[model samples]
Target: MVTQRSSRVRLEWGPIGADRIVEPDCLAVVVDVLSFTTALTVAVQVGAEVYPYAWDRQDLGTYAAARDAHHAVGRYEAQRSDSLTSVSLSPRSLAVSSGLKRLVLPSPNGSTISFRLRDSGATVVGVSLRNRAAVAAWLDAALEDDPARVLALVAAGERWDDGSLRPAVEDLWGCGALLAGLRDRGADVLREASPEAHVALAAYDAVADDLEAGLVACDSGQELVRAGFRDDVVDAAQLDVSAVVPVLSGERFVDARRPLGE
Candidate 1:
């Protein structure tokens, strides 16, 4: 209970934080700016039904096959191949993939957290730097609809080589982007935002002038760059470009612009 940051809005890092903060009355927003959620936003923008999967799931391809969806590949895997059979967790890949109606996206960070949070009794929403403003607007409308609903912004930080949480700054910035945008949407929401949420808002204010630069200089960005995926970082650095609010309905993330049933 103490770790839940009991307030109208809260900000926390990693999967453990996600478990602590979310409940049936909470709107859990998962932010993975380096790729997962960014890719998710792009997929949803193109009207694709996205299924989030565990990062360690060995049956990702099998799952996608059963559902007749494209199993998202790693950027390196997609880049190394000439096959047009699938897209990756890179926003650029999903952005260019035509007729992408269904996708089973997996990741070490965002997808893992998202998959686990599906039955957590909270309304899970996906966000990244690209669609923070649109999601904030959606959140404002959501607040109006259910005055009792609370917010939990979870930063799905990366993992170290040993598979431990690395607390990536890119995700922190992504969470901050959403925090500041939501605060700008309404005054009431700010009143009960946790202190940790304010800390994230402060970070957002610091990077507001140069989000692209922030992403370009972060450790995750450098790693992705060395791996030949700098374009993915740039794709996620954009702000408010997408109005697609990815809401978790059943096991898939459907764009909030359309009905969840669709």
Candidate 2:
């Protein structure tokens, strides 16, 4: 329990960290700022249900067809699509995609984390820079109803060349953004935060003012920008612009404030 960072809010990196932090009474918040969770946020905000796919399979098209959902392609593929319906892991690709009812977004970090946590007996939530404040507010109300619940904030950092966790700074900033919002609600939660969680919050506060510039300067951000998808990085840098909170229901995600099937 001590290694678990026994606080109302805990912080860790990647899917392995997710496995360690999640509990039946925990809200497992997945933060993947580069694209996955950002895309999920935009999709859910526009009333689309997102299904996380491992994205490492060759049968991606068949997989999407089986689920009756459109499979998101790569960002470069999305950009060349004849229509905006060509969804991808990029949040910018989801712009003007309101008619899309369902999307199978695949990612190595965020999607994998979500997939691993689906059966962990913890409530899973999708978090990004786009909806951090909304999620934090939503959490405040949800936790109020269940006093025993804690927050397991997982930053789905990128992987290194050796397939080890890269611990991307943007993901840490994203988690810190949520933590900053959560801690603002009261002194108790702020005090209950683990030192690691506090580190994340401090990370966010340090560069919240120039987040866009900060993102553009980061390794992951530069990768996307150099690929001619700078728009994706720019779109993701916007903070707390979305009010929609995506909660994983079954295998897909839906808006938390909206009743299921509504």
Candidate 3:
């Protein structure tokens, strides 16, 4: 009889904690709902190339200077992004230049968190609602080599002054839900395990009429609104939207066609 393989699914919430647990051989899924991840989905679909860099502005500047042309994409309140092109920019702009040699991306949380995990031994893949099903399928196939434990890190925003996390509920819900779905291969497992799936499901249930409200209430959902990327939010939130897995290959992220035919 063929032996059955049993894999334990580990669920992690915060960026730091998730980063600490990542191993080189494992698969790393980084989620930053409040825009970065959402924007990434849009950029890729729009045919824009994405180069992720560590949040060090000096390094980013150096990278950009080497490139031909680029644009910055990010939130304003961040620090050290004034000189770069940014969106939702304030104190420092989160920058992503188009066609630039370097993409100086600095999010309050996503970039640093990505760097930490990327530094680890594990294989890193960028996942958001848009590519959730693709990620799951990739994990299933990668596990064939027993590459390593697969880890999903939700780059949820920081905590509130009360020490309670703002946006915690949605991301935590999403991550846990993802774990639940991955653990089982059944069709229902897909919907059962995803927090992103649940949020959308609930919204559909409550306001089958007002999709905008349901997405806005979620932190990551709201970030998409602020960035004027509603189409991306709805698209990413779909299950199995793409048959291919979007992975980090050297500098830019590429869509690796599906490993197995569905």
Candidate 4:
């Protein structure tokens, strides 16, 4: 009997920078379960071709008007402000649709990361627990084609009064898991990862089932559950499905690009 060895993989965790410049040479995987990425993964799985627009407040009106958008959608952060109400809303279906013929996204954190990476030389992909498996497979194919030197993992967070708003550890847990799987398969290419990656992976493993057992534990996960999207979360964590890597092309997420496998 022969035993397979675990492939060595490395990953790093960090925040989006000011310019939020995403290195084009590396493959980027953006994860935000709170809403945008979560909804994006679900919507793609649900058959909606998601097109992400700029999160800049000024850009919203222009895009909405040009697209003949009927509704404008955003997060509680933007809508909570007295002046931003005209363009913000909760992360609901109506908010998802907003008033546009197509979806116009202005999220507090997720959209910012997505927009920044909009033109990186490397391919940008959306990920959440729901499409983890699919993403892993997609990554495998990318590695087979051209191994990446840097795999940037961005996590989104809330805005606080003291500028101390950082992404939740729960969010990192998922990223760590992805990093772990990437390393396990030797697909991350660069062989660079955070020392804490294993720690985060173990923590998430301990509470992986909490996604179902404690529905209200995580803010975004809970929000989706309350919004009647529990099924989305359950499916999001499945690990692998289509193996179709979802990449960001301009403003839309296109899966037509086959994995390196094909």
Top candidate (lDDT): 1
Stretches of candidate 2 above 4 Å error? 79-84
Clash-forming residue pairs, model 2: none
Q: Per-residue CA lDDT of candidate 1, range 130-179, in tens?
A: 89999989888888888778889899999988988888888888888887
TM-score of each: 0.96, 0.94, 0.64, 0.69
Q: After superposition, how far is residue 163 of candidate 3 from its true place, in Å?
A: 12
How many clashes (backbone N, Cα, C below 3 Å) per candidate? 0, 0, 26, 21
How large an RMSD does model 3 have?
A: 7.5
Local distance difference test, each candidate: 0.87, 0.86, 0.49, 0.55
* True-structure lDDT of candidate 3: 0.49
Please give, for residues 112-181, the per-residue lDDT of candidate 4 as tens digits.
6676667667567777665666677667776677643445566565555575556565567667656656
**Cα RMSDs, all models:** 1.4, 1.7, 7.5, 7.6
What is the Cα-based TM-score of model 3? 0.64
Task: Give the best candidate by TM-score.
Answer: 1
* Error at 176, model 3, angstroms: 4.4
Query: Arrange candidates by TM-score, highest first: which order?
Result: 1, 2, 4, 3
lDDT of 3 by residue, 164-230 (tens): 4455444443453344345444432332233433443343345435434555667666765676655
